[model samples]
Target: MLRTVATRTRVGAVRVVQRRNASNVAVQNIESRWSTLSTAEQNTIAKQLEEAQKGDWKSLSLDEKKAAYYIAFGAHGPRAPITKPGHASKVVAGVAGVLAASSALFYAIRLGGQEKPHTISKEWEEATNEYLKSQNSNPISGISSEGYKGTGYVVSK
Candidate 1:
């Protein structure tokens, strides 16, 4: 019984090794078929490439090198383009719609809004400066300061 169990165990281990080696064989036409391969097949190819790279790099076949490079830098998965076709046109249209809506809102508000306040006039601002001077408002470096040259409340055109 012991002999039979040991033989069976050895045979099972050998079978597992053979299965692994079979899977790790270089995939034929890897470039043409890589994208269409199932995950398992792709993984097998990756593993094969990894093993090939573990040796002297010069010993790596052209296919193995190409496969490794593709796996690392191919335009697939996260490296693929996020935008679909006509994405730029869609973005431009969205921006144009928003701008048109904003322009419409702005014109509507301007036409319906009240006139500018009386305080916005240059004469009113000059009066404000005089009042500030009289009231000692902002005495330090301001309207009430000595030789103050800064424009004070006079932005109206």
Candidate 2:
């Protein structure tokens, strides 16, 4: 008796899988028929749909209903497509926002620990100035490195 029940359950599962495949095939057939219709036929169907009252919708032929469905949603049915909107953008924006906030919090924490904000070392400043002067052909056009104080973790280290 138990073995018979187990066999029946397995058969039911197989039937469910087969039903799903059949459903998919039926949907594909509907989509293909809708697509193959000429522009004039589509327009005529759309006009019919637009003129159709809510109560009269059920009166429409299967083909006409299928056309209406196509009009409502391009290719896919009523359900949303597998691919979602703003998925990549949402992830990128979320990650970027989190990283930016974390870095800013880290910087603020580091800055809080320092009593007097440290300035750039005199030797490093002089060396940088020398390098800039040597590399720059147009001194007036280049950025001025002087009169700026370097603070936070960089200065502390």
Highest lDDT scorer: 1
**lDDT at position 32, candidate 2:** 62
Cα lDDT of model 1 by residue, 1-157, tens digit: 9999999999987875565456445554566777788998788778767766775887555666777888888777788789999999999999999999999999999999999898889999989988888999888888889899988878876
Candidate 2, residue 114: the lDDT equals 57
Candidate 1 segments exceeding 4 Å error: 1-32, 54-61, 149-151
lDDT of 2 by residue, 70-143 (tens): 67876544554766887889899999999999999999998878564334665565666656656753345443
Pairs in steric clash, model 2: none
Listed in order, each prediction's TM-score against the native is: 0.65, 0.27
- What's the distance in Å from true for residue 22, model 1? 9.8
Model 2 ranges with Cα > 4 A deviation: 1-42, 48-59, 69-105, 108-113, 116-157
Q: What is the lDDT of residue 105 in candidate 2?
A: 99
lDDT of 2 at 135: 70
* Candidate 2 local Cα displacement, residue 7, angstroms: 60
